[model samples]
Target: MKTRSMYKAERTSLNRLPDPVLETILCLLPTKEAVRTSILSREWRYKWTHIPKLRFELRDTTSELTSDIETAMNAMDMYDVYRVLLLHRGPIHELTLYFDHYWEHYEAFECDQIILHLLRNHTLNKLTLFGLYETEDIWYKLPASVFALHHLTDLHLCTFDIDHPSIFNGFGSLQKLVLSYVKISTKTLLHLLSNCPSLNTLDLHIDDYEHVDNCTINELLKCLPLIEHLTISGDVSQWLVLDSVPQELPTLIHLKYLCLNQYCISGDYGSAFLLALIKCSPNLEHAHLEMEYLLEFSVVKDKYSDVWLAHLNTLDLCFCSSSLEIEFVKFMLARSPKLKKVSILTVVDRKQDAKMVKTLLRAPRASRGVKICTWK
Candidate 1:
């Protein structure tokens, strides 16, 4: 039963809250929204300066909005971001800036300096900077100082490459890292990962890999021993053994969650890759694998040694076509003793999906208690 005037009075009283409390409220808002509060009153004019986090977003999910920003900013938006950081006081807990850096007049060196300044001065817990897309102007490499953030906990950098540094001792406190369309050599990538001893999560999304070989790749993967959640999507054809066989296999003893999305590998290699992963991750609880594979002669036995996905409870197989893949699926069905449910996914119509489901339901399984299902 409160009148409209009473609500206004209550809201006006909120302006008198302690500065720390007001900064907490501002920290939850986006940088633009927080800055807008300055017009509310003289008391709120400087509250945004003390916020612990600042996020400047140039575009949202729509590509049209991206075009709009490109039209409006004319590639001068970096200065605005630099000014915002310059105005912010104290250590920023989190900073996420996503803007287009693809323009003929863009100053790559200045942007690099600005990013380095933020990393050097802030005690950031989460830092995400997504650079320009691949379909744009010249490529921009992130400053080597990005690897020297000792206070970062979660980092996601996109559309850039890192130069090999003479000395590396950063990302010691980092727990999660995500790289999208990042150009990195195997040797450099290994060196970076080796420095992050506390890292537990890694997500890689790239269109290609350079000079990828199995011998060194397998060895380097061993550097990340504590990773529990792993997601490798996009074009892995360069690293995945599609033209030949895996010369070496990497074992991960701590992995529990895995997702392989639309990898460009054939059936035999796909089956072999998944088997190798299952063998390595003994404690894996769930897996989602959906990709292309070879259509060669099936080579699967009733047993694949004493290896067991002992804790695995759910399996999702999607976009399968080859009969060799069916054998691999059957082999996994016979291999997983503790498996409780398996979902076979197909891109066919409802009738075809029903037929595949029926076929799989009739297939022999090692886990007598496992339920078989299908989806289209």
Candidate 2:
């Protein structure tokens, strides 16, 4: 067994590792834990300050801690974030801040100041800021300076809104963007998408669909010609057919993965919207659809002709055991010649779900090797 002196010698030798290797090790630790390493030895005093990636999460302690204690801890955590940025020596390539505030009020001004400080460093490649709730009143308003990060490749913003898109310069290097419950106007949203030429992955979930219309939705689709993976959730999918059924929208030639959550495929208009997207995405390989409801009386037969999902390999559907949904499954099974697997998560009684699964298994498939799996 190793003695105390032997362990001390080994730790000293480990601490003497190259600065790059040491920084990498520190980066793997939590921001708070990394800061605690400064007390280990004199050599590790400023090691964490050079780490390129930093993540700070302020959690809510309403259940475990008293209100006063929780408030004090939150203030200290926020201060620590400021302290880390001030003492940080090198460039920060990525940063993530999650504020789980359950209090009635928060200092939005301090958060703005932190963003302002980050603006001085243009080397950020990935930035994720998630707020506690989706309300526009409490959500942090992203300043115009955020658009100046030209080197950003991946960005995820939740419950954030931009006031001035006119000052936006655009992210030319950005490839992946996720906007969850972001309150953005149609014009600003279009401007943001038109400038990102390299964007390939887009995950959009808009709660305020009243402000957006069908024409703007079509324009949004046009802006994402190079998108390979697309996810549309919330009420936005229903908004796709607000004005009229899409006849001819821009084809997403590069689209491979598609995910639709709480999307309605009921009625003629909804059917048209769904068919239009699938018709355009000829190269789609994987599709995940979570349906809200599919009315039996309103179900429309295939209107689009000469459509085939030749590249589709996997299909995942989460829906109630409605006849319209089963019909949709049968339609896809007949068209997807290369489909290998179909997974269904039924939101119905176990007996009804089993019967639905049996019906699907008996349906004629274009690909004889396709496997149908189901679970309730």
Candidate 3:
């Protein structure tokens, strides 16, 4: 009697839910763990395919599996991954697959095939592929199959080379994109941006080899109009400047949060163009600008008269001490009628930050609500 009761209890816990509800619960687990649910009974044999989100990731951690990834072990893992993609029936809403550095070049091909097959058959909405290559210059090229998944709304590719796509179409659905260390040319980059018409949040990582040619930084801003939050960083993009403001701009009028880190500001095209961009962003509420090195300012003809940032409320600037940056602080305090808070951080050692704060406190006039602060 005791043995029978224990057996009944075990079955009750495992097979308590309806098939649809059980599949939904299992989908919350990683793909590897989700597949194991089939061991419960014949009823769950292929139920894992009903999961809408499939994720598989292996990292180079101190785990025992990473320590002994033999050829047989890799083959088994790849087989399981392929089987999951091949059997999945419903529309996959998201896929996150990261290949550890332990895998060799040959293994990447298998993974690529699985990715292509998954994207082709399913209405995949979000995809993240992190190819942590063990060897340099051994980047997994994205297949032409990815472009057709028009339902895709988010994409993230890390350390992948998108050298020559077979064709460029079936895009413009993505609203959030993150490309970290992707090898794409300027032309291809622009084309990609043009496709994402409603891009509101962008995190772009530019390499020393990739840059915009026909468009300078200012002109490139025109490509993204709906951007409310932006982060532009990396070595090559640091020194980029605005050659000329466009005849007309699809400006960042609605942009409210902006961050520019490690970006070089040349005096000639830097100061005015930045001010012009800020003026265009009338609804901008928060801004953080970092200047890497002091640069000369060249006089550009005014693109717009009566510069006003009526909606700006907070501004943060960090850089080595300079009179120009201070002038910018004073400029903001005077122009932004709704300003309330400002922060200035100087990279200089033993500099008079408190004194600078006092100076800004005294020189500012337009907004009485503004509270100026400085950091060393």
Question: Which numbered prediction scores highest in TM-score against the true structure?
Answer: 2
Across 101-124, the per-residue lDDT of candidate 3 in tens digits comes to 635534456655766787667778
TM-score, cand. 1 vs. native: 0.81
Q: Give the per-residue lDDT of model 2 (tens digit) for 47-163.
A: 888888888876544435546754444333666788889898888889887776623344456666777787775388998888766445555667555677788899898887655
> What TM-score does each of the candidates earn?
0.81, 0.86, 0.75
Cα lDDT over the full model 1 = 0.69
lDDT of each: 0.69, 0.76, 0.68
User: Could you arrange the candidates by TM-score from highest to lowest?
Assistant: 2, 1, 3
Segments in model 3 whose C-alpha atoms lie over 4 Å from true places = 1-30, 33-50, 58-76, 86-90, 102-104, 133-138, 164-166, 210-214, 235-241, 244-249, 264-268, 297-305, 343-345, 349-351, 363-367, 371-376
Provide the clashing-pair count of each candidate structure: 4, 0, 4
Candidate 2: TM-score?
0.86
Clash pairs of candidate 2? none
